[model samples]
Target: MGHQQTVSTTFTSAVGERIGASLALVDAELARRYPGDPGTRQPVHTVYVPADAFDAATVRSWGEGALAALDRHAPDAASFAAVLGIPDRLAGPVYDRVRAKLRREPVEDLRIDFEDGYGLRPDAEEDAAAARAAQLVARACAEGTAPPWTGIRMKCMEAAVRDRGVRTLDVFLTGLLEAGGLPEGLVLTLPKVSYPEQVAAMVHLAEEFEKARGLDGGRIRFEVQIETTQSILGADGRATVARLIEAGQGRVTSLHYGTFDYSAACGVSAAHQSADHPAADHAKAVMQVAAAGTGVRLCDGSTNVLPVGPRERVHAAWRLHHGLVRRALARAYYQGWDMHPGQLPTRYAAVYAFYREGLEEAAGRLAAYAGGGGGAVLDEPATARALSGYLLRGLDCGALDAEEVAALTGLDRAALDRLAGRTAPQD
Candidate 1:
């Protein structure tokens, strides 16, 4: 039906094959270095408790405390919405969901802190605390009372505390092994990491532990806490974060930003030290890029402002915390650190409002894209992936109901999972 071409093609299949062969090494390297997201349900926030202070009742107590705060201050949807400026359309739903989430799962990811929160205790006291932490965590996991994710934060790999940190981790892991096998949601955090060697050291520790326990390799994964300037930028003037991730050797699950420590490391005045500071932004931005496509999630730091004291003071703190959380969500930092239970209300409120505000539009666009029907906005596959991911996250956090998401997007959970590049669950 068409006219024949007059000229012969200059390139052939052989030429393309040669080019592919030449780039095979690069393809393999890319696959190794940037494996993309792991497609797991990342927790919305990580709550840190002192190793000695954590107990079976800690999770429930936090939930009760958060509920009490809601009752005392913003007792209803309208009042809570007024404090956080939630829209009328979203107020009741967000308020109801926030309360339900507090009652159901107040803390998603919990870290038993032996670092800053625990401070430097005597060797004996720290040892006892570490053992006790393992016992409580194992028991909680067995009783189905633990948060979905729970872990310990050992001290840094710095020379001063290197052996002590290793010893504490050993004791903790040994305790867990003795009690039973390690739980599936067990996490480890190595804080104040300033060099790639520290990450390597963590890997080594994990490997040695696995070998000694005869456990599977790569079974233990930890988070690298980026708190020092050196962790972001090396003395050789390169993005040290990339090297840190590399040194992790496929064992780093996430990178957590430390607000005050990082700001203070940058010489930020105590009064000016906040998560929104320019310095913190730069650190987190670099973290985001370094973590992108690397299967490592990013967590923003916590705001030290606690919603305690008089009702007026609590309201002000709630407003501040809510604004900060919303800002972080806008920047695509889905997870953060929550220092106190008081911040839980505003945290959920901001997260819910963010998803709810954009829900209709996102759902419409995704539905159109999935159905191959044109929409106002031309969306690429990547955008579809993000949109599906957004809705799935909302659904997972209870901000969006599964039925409503299915109705809005015209795609069920399995369809969403496929679009988001996650493996659908087996029937």
Candidate 2:
């Protein structure tokens, strides 16, 4: 016993420090700044209007007008149900709630575009428009009629027009903050970013604006638009999503894919610049992978086809928009751009149908997994996470309510919250 020698199996101090450093790097890589719960009202699409055309009242009216058009286009609940292929029982309720939503707050995220939509207006005119927008935003904010998310899409900072872009941003922000204060849920959209420096510059400007406005450090958030090949694949032949996010300094809220612009960058024909185009898909895939687990939202571009004019043409356009929306949903991009009021109906129709059709199955799987038994079917941890996310998204979108999900999934509010927070599970 006295001759027995002690042996040490513990790691040396240097080796332990190296392991700690490796883990620290991994944690940093997986770090995320979530935008947090968007509350009960999450808009499925953002409707962009030219800067000159934007006003709170007019925007609300646009939504009402869109609802009226949808009503005329699909007169009865039965016809609407047939068009969207939802259960007849849900037809009237879905139509009613959708109309009510549109009437009350037609546009969720309204982007007052000064870039492509507004073009190069006269300086004086643009100044006037900017002031008017700020005034309307203030008014809407005071009245509580402001959409949950609202912002201006400034022109990009390319060398040729960087001055004008900064000028427009300064004027708009100055007026907005002066009119009371920053609107609740205000965000900026930086379009056609070609390099990481562009994002860094935008983030810097946001910091400056926040300081001037007396807002918090991260209050002035922005979403970047991936419109060019360079935006997806940097000049160095590597993906640029992570770089752009880093350059935003944790203030980036979402990444919007510009289908037409990206396709054009790839030299694709005008006839084939749709969201489902291969080039667009590749860009979106790169975006998803880079932004995964980062809480950065993704928005697909709009369908160029507008549902107007003759009945046949309108119907055809509706079919096209609906098809594209379905494809986006399949790809897990819940939000897209709605170019016209008419597209509103199809947007909701497709969204409601997508969630509705899979409700029961998703519910069963989630309930089984959450119950710990998992007796219904084998579920990997990732699959469990996906099921929970699907239900949570539906709940956020108002497609499914707390009580409904609870009844289907046997999960109460607290359990659902826990499920949402279940990023990892010990095996």
Candidate 3:
């Protein structure tokens, strides 16, 4: 772990640090796009947000009032307590309900969002909520209050320009620091990352925020919402994401496929924005290419149509958490989301099963290789060759325990020792 940490710190530059982001070496950009190919069978870490929750009237009201309190907070005992209590008082029920739902969700599939998961709108009332949510988000990141991962759709730079006086994006970040001293490593996702410049600008802002807030700037992660034609097929589209990271100092952590916006960007029928659709898959591949090309995590957007009726909902839950989730995991997603509690179990199972399956496959290969006493020729097309990379990918998921890895391969720590000397590292 220590060695690995050192390697990451070396490779990943912190925000605002004078680190150089070099992508000029890749030569050409993505040669091929991911046909929204979910990938080689692992659950993508799904950050589920409650878009509908933000629509509720009460949430909107809470946003306005939260900021009013922030504006007048002072250096008095009463004021300080009032400030401390604000999050608990205003965000308590909202957080509790979300937390409870997460806990009870049929699966341990992780869900991340704030103020109900969607980005804050620019309306006056919602500004305060956005600020509060930002603070809450920071606290969660700093404190590990929930799962290890979470994502937020912060205000787009364009949106900020349109909103006039109050810069909601900055407020959101401020709230985060005030809430809990940057307790968490938050993944701030930007919507509609159309041009490389947009991506670059956002990265710069993120880096600035980190420096200003006194947090490890590079530690502040990011996910780009790929939803524009310019990002996919434009003349520079192939290299758009590449260029963005190069210019922005390489802070991108993941590239997410935004289906709805992609459909529109493609000038296709919006009604047919299903993941299974050929066009949607094409766009996902574009995103995958960008991600794969740049060595970042790739995630697909949520399936919009959800099951609602009792039986349908149950089945819907299964289809998503199991069918889709399993399929996605098998395609090699780090994790994926169950939008509702009902879908959680299947999502969890699929994610777990992915790593478990891989571990077992790897163990068998390594054990057999050990038995061969280094004389075994690992047929590139067969068990040993396949298992090498296979096992490593399983480890990447960070889902399995050492014992679990051992169980899958029937190899104890001692056996692994022998194999490591005999085998080469898998890709």
Task: For each of the candidates, give the backbone clash count.
Answer: 0, 0, 36
Question: For residues 126-222, what per-residue lDDT tens digits would candidate 3 score against the true structure?
Answer: 5665665565555444644434444456545455442421255666667766775553445566666667777777766778887877777576656
lDDT of 2 by residue, 134-214 (tens): 788778888888878888898998987687788888888888788888876787889999899999999888888878767
Off by over 4 Å in 2: 1-18, 32-42, 87-93, 422-427
Candidate of highest TM-score: 1
Q: Extract clashing residue pairs from model 2.
A: none
Model 3 Cα shift for residue 165 (angstroms): 12
Tell me the lDDT of candidate 2: 0.80
Indicate whether candidate 2 or candidate 3 has the larger TM-score.
2
- The predictions' CA RMSDs to the true structure, in order, are 1.7, 4.8, 15.4
Q: Can you rank all candidates by TM-score, best first?
A: 1, 2, 3
lDDT of 1: 0.93
TM-score of every model versus the real structure: 0.97, 0.90, 0.64
In model 3, state the lDDT of residue 136.
Answer: 53
